[model samples]
Target: MSLNYPAEGRNYIMDAAIHGGQQIGTWYVALYEGDYTPQEDDTAANIGARATEITAYTELTRPELVESAATGGASDNTGNLAQFTLSAPKTVRGFAVVSSAGKGTNTGKLLAYQRLATPRAYAAGDVVKVPVSLILSNPA
Candidate 1:
């Protein structure tokens, strides 16, 4: 299924597929982010947002089918390394693996992967390393 999300200055679309299976559950969700055309200053400008959706209860396939359509990256280290500062230490349950870029002068091009946090303690300026690059369903 497809859905549209409203944003202040951007457009967003989300797609999801629920696999119809047995006891357990599986779903694949993809989000699209983009900006409307034209800018108030008569210049070419755009904005984008990420999209996420909940899977329906009637899905009957593997979420991979849907994820395949969405943006995805392979599992590899040294792909995209990012640094973020946490205002306060919090338990990172999950994260949306968006696009990733590295900052090292000699860093190689790497895919970005978002995953749960490790050790559970994150101080300010703690860096997060995502290994795979998520599908560019959304363009910012």
Candidate 2:
């Protein structure tokens, strides 16, 4: 099974109507080891897995990152699911989309996270691939 939209993120986005400084910047997909867990007090700084994050697969640099489709952004089901191929062995349990390319509390602000229903354990010589789609839309 794949990841579902998180309640933490749902609350955050819902509260944005009353909040003033809540803004999502560039989105980058970050893969974590099977041991990583999503935390409520997560900041951008320490978002990477403990020495287990795939470096090249950590910060996916893309032009049309992701934004709120409900607010005149891109349409749904259109290039929203990001596809990634593992070049090396990776025991991935979950992934996230962040705001920056750098790390640390002030830099690596995580926007969303999802844990795979089944872990993806890829070997060095294996062709591993997964699609992580960001669903940014209205509840209506």
Worst lDDT run of 10 residues, candidate 1, spans 102-111
Residue 97, model 2: lDDT of 64
Residue 109 of model 1: what lDDT? Answer: 15
TM-scores, all candidates, are: 0.27, 0.60
* Candidate 1: C-alpha lDDT: 0.24
Tell me the lDDT of candidate 2: 0.54
Candidate 1 local lDDT, residue 28 = 22
TM-score of 1: 0.27
Off by over 4 Å in 1: 1-77, 98-119, 133-140
Cα lDDT of model 2 by residue, 51-118, tens digit: 24554433344223443354343232244544445556778777666666542223635566677766
lDDT of 1 by residue, 4-73 (tens): 1223112111111234322212222211112222222211011112221111112232112112223252
